[model samples]
Target: MPLWLMILLGTIFGGLIFFAIFMFVRSRKKSKEALGASAGETSKYAGQAPPEPEVLAGQVAAIREHDAAFDEGRFLKWAEETFFKVQESWTERQASGARALMTDACFADHERRIGELLAKNEKNELDALAVSGTAIMGIESDKQTDTITVRFNAQCADYTVNAETGEVVRGNKAVGAWVEDWVFMRARPDYLAGGGEMPAGGLETNWRLARIDEVMG
Candidate 1:
């Protein structure tokens, strides 16, 4: 080979070798950086261990059992606590008010309208029977970003009072049946019944939806 040709070939080969070494070193550096970053991530996660798989299963099972029991029980305890607790005093007050506010014929006519089919039993101590009923309630499950709708049945016991004497007549239990539908909207939170006003007293009373936003529904 000529002298110039030999020099040129030597330079080209040397350049190629240098380029290959540079590439190898660059790749190794990059791989080390990546591995270090990955190790950091792994260490961070390692500090917080995952929950046991059996724990999740147990929680799910408990929730299922609670739901089943609530369904079977018809949420009677919830109803009694919510309904009677709020209305017990009001109902008794209304019973006392009825004597001064209503006349015998008016009361009798009201009873006939209700299909109670009662005869004039006695005067001084006339017994009255309010009844138990099914109450419709809506419960909600809340999260940071959303809410879920939950529905359950509840039963409220009936309230009774003496018609003429305005005394609570608990000798015989009084019960009624009520079925209602409730709707839940995500945007409203301050719903009320009877337009947020106090409920009026009556026999076998029906609960009216005044402000639905207040309800959990």
Candidate 2:
């Protein structure tokens, strides 16, 4: 999912939510780049150190201060759903469907790739997809924003085809798997917990997909 995961990591959005444009483009050689995308574009945070478990615990605790309702289980579900929808959009080379879930920068990245596919009348096809597991790697925040990184592990048959004749163009239709680190960001809410009542906001909104980094094996 090079241009994305369009999957763009929107391949999933730039990298399945990246069946990622990079996956196929990251294709590394698989179909449409598949979820098993290539390592084409590297995320800026790829090589940085991850927060230790203890630190991450503190980070989650801090997030709870901002969002008392933050739940890892529910967050992962959102991540999973985002992955599926972005992948679906990637297949169609349409990035808008996932616009609501991504930051403008992230959305732009996926959009650029989808546009390329449309210009060429090509489509990335990802199928037989299954997520084995998803987990958080890190969580942090600036004075005005919150950020979190999550890892997605999944498999699928990936390939690209000529939109008109359905001819195999660049990738193979073989099934394969991939791992990606998706970063999400959002503006800080107007209020923070002062040990008082928390906002009613759920884990949705207030956060948007920021970036996706392919985990190089």
Candidate 3:
């Protein structure tokens, strides 16, 4: 390879590696930083109220038309459970355990993250991880799918450890709280009823997380 070409290739490869590490660190324990909490702060949002569900009134009504069983209270309960379930899987690096609870794209992203951690011989530790509150912050629907954005108030002491040496490579072990938005989606019956293409499954498909987004304080 030409010298300049080699240098360019090396730079690109190095950038990708850095990006992967950056994303992994952000996902694992940067919630406080993302939420603008200082190092001495505990859980900044521990006493915070979840967004009012009233904002999603219209979206809930629309979703109920497709599946009358849709209930805000019930869904919030399930979402809170899901927050714990997914966090357990993430900390354990067992993407398979969360496959059914996430959309294909979401699953793929998590699976790849797990693979990368394994390759690097690192693990994210989430001790005392807990969700204090969960609520439907917003919802939207189309002929294809009904999507809900859930806001979660959670706290955890997250750190990355070396798998073999068991040394904490990053993050403080202090428990900190942060708020985040998790988006879940379910296929609409009409989309399947029409036999048209969709991002995921058809009739009787359960709600699955499509994505997770950081909520800035």
Candidate 4:
């Protein structure tokens, strides 16, 4: 080959090598910059604090309503709907929806024991008295946990019986007291009354509604 041709070929080969090296260096710098940016982002997130969970405003309102209901002597209604509803569901064998209101040991064996007693006393008229007029002495609220403990001064009345067989059972007006604790959880009154297996989970409304009413008397 001629010297000119050799020189021209050599120049072309050198230019190709230089171009490859330049591209490789540029790519490596770009990769390193991207890695550094990613690291900075990750470190920032790791060092930063997380946001707190927000409590609903409606929960506060519900809490107030619960207190008002109790003060107004509507607890019997609440118990009939909430407590009795749970008991009813458990007896009906659809216990999934209603949270086990009573402890396992409290009424495990005597599921329908209360109901049986009440049924026997069906003929006797029962008058539910107000907490203020009867035995409810005082109530105190726990701010931290949002719980209320109502102290009672139990006042109960007895039924009357005929004197045909020397059975004169007069109404007994005795002040007896009982206390119950309530929490807000998914409660299905319909499910407890008749609806079968409650859905897997119940709603937690953050507040309980209380209702009171007289039955027999």
Candidate 5:
């Protein structure tokens, strides 16, 4: 071959080899970066430990120790009954019956709502109130108080009526199911007590409704 032709061939071959080497090095670097990212993600998740089951058990035991009458079944029963009574109080456009069953703040909220209804001459009526199921969602006790949150699924015939003429206004008479969470609170006792009887005459009770919130699915 002539000298110029040989020089051109050599240059082209060298260029091809260099390009190949560059591509191989770039690919290896990308692979290493991807693997490093994956490992970092794995370690991040693995560093978090799940809560121990015994921790929750210990919390419940502590709460039970504070109130000897702290039976889950009994508390749930009371919650169901109180739910109905609260609905009844709303229907009657009064809060007297539920006053003893609620905390001061909760009672104040109820009275405020009732006052608003009374000002508008309106009342809510709930008939055939039936609780389908109830579940204890959580229980906790602090230095001075114990709180239990319960979830209730119930059906009731709801309607808004005019207080003066007793006429249906807003809601229909059909029964509808609703989900609600009710929080109950009581003073944390230093010693265990035997009876679960609710205290009378005082605005505060051993178990009183703290708040109620609707749960949306």
Candidate 6:
């Protein structure tokens, strides 16, 4: 082979080897940096504290201790049933059926509202009422009364009709979602001295709905 040709071939091979080495080193450095960043991120997340779940659990435990016979499941079922029944009674313009399930003030308010509707010759009608979800949001008690507030998410077909003409006056027939907070109250008797028992037939003898407020948003 000619010396010039041999020298040219050697230079080309050396340059190729150097380029490969440079690329390999650059990639290795980048991999290390990426791995380090991932590790740092993991460590940072691990070091942060998470919110405690015990707060709500502790509150529930305290409420349980306050009333031994207070069954959460039973109360929730009763609340849901009462909610639907009250709505039905309201639409029917009769508070007598639900009066036993509510406080005096609450019943009076309901009666006044029904009276207004009657005077206006209008009636609110609800169909396909269903409780989608229910939860006890709060519990409080004093020397005389114990109140348990519950959140109810429900959907129904709500509309108003003119009583005289039997025609739709307001609201749509489409199903609409609504949220409400209902407060049920019971007299604080000698619960610690063995006193809390819901009447055999129903909660009408023990629990009375204090008030109801709609939840927005």
lDDT scores in order: 0.30, 0.68, 0.71, 0.33, 0.63, 0.65
Give the per-residue lDDT of model 3 (tens digit) for 59-173: 7787888788889989989988887788778778777888888877777777887787788898887778777877776778877777787777788787778999989877757
lDDT of 4 by residue, 49-98 (tens): 32222322243344555343333245434533544454344333343334
Give a tens-digit lDDT track for model 6, residues 1-217. Answer: 9999999999999999999877654543332221100011111112223223475456556667756677778888998888878887887888687888877777777777778778999887776878889877766775556777777778766667799887866655666675567777876655534555533222333788777654521
User: What TM-score against the true fold does each predicted structure earn?
Assistant: 0.21, 0.72, 0.73, 0.24, 0.65, 0.66
Give per-residue CA lDDT, model 5, range 1-217, as digits (tens).
Answer: 9999999999999999999877544543332221100011111112223224575457567777756666777778988888878777766766787888887777776777777678889777666878889877677775556778777777766666788898876665666665566777876555224334443323233788877654521
Please estimate how well model 6 matches the true structure, expressed as its whole-model Cα lDDT: 0.65
Cα lDDT, model 1, residue 88:
32
Clashes of 1: 11
* Model 3: residues with Cα > 4 Å off, grouped in runs: 1-54, 198-204
Judge candidate 3 against the unseen true structure and give its global Cα lDDT, from 0 to 1: 0.71
Worst 10 residues of 5 by lDDT: 35-44
TM-score: which candidate is best?
Answer: 3
Error of 3 at 88 (Å): 1.4
Q: What is the Å distance of residue 77 in model 2 from its true position?
A: 0.9
Q: Is candidate 3 or candidate 6 better by lDDT?
A: 3
Candidate 3: worst-modelled 10 consecutive residues by lDDT: 34-43
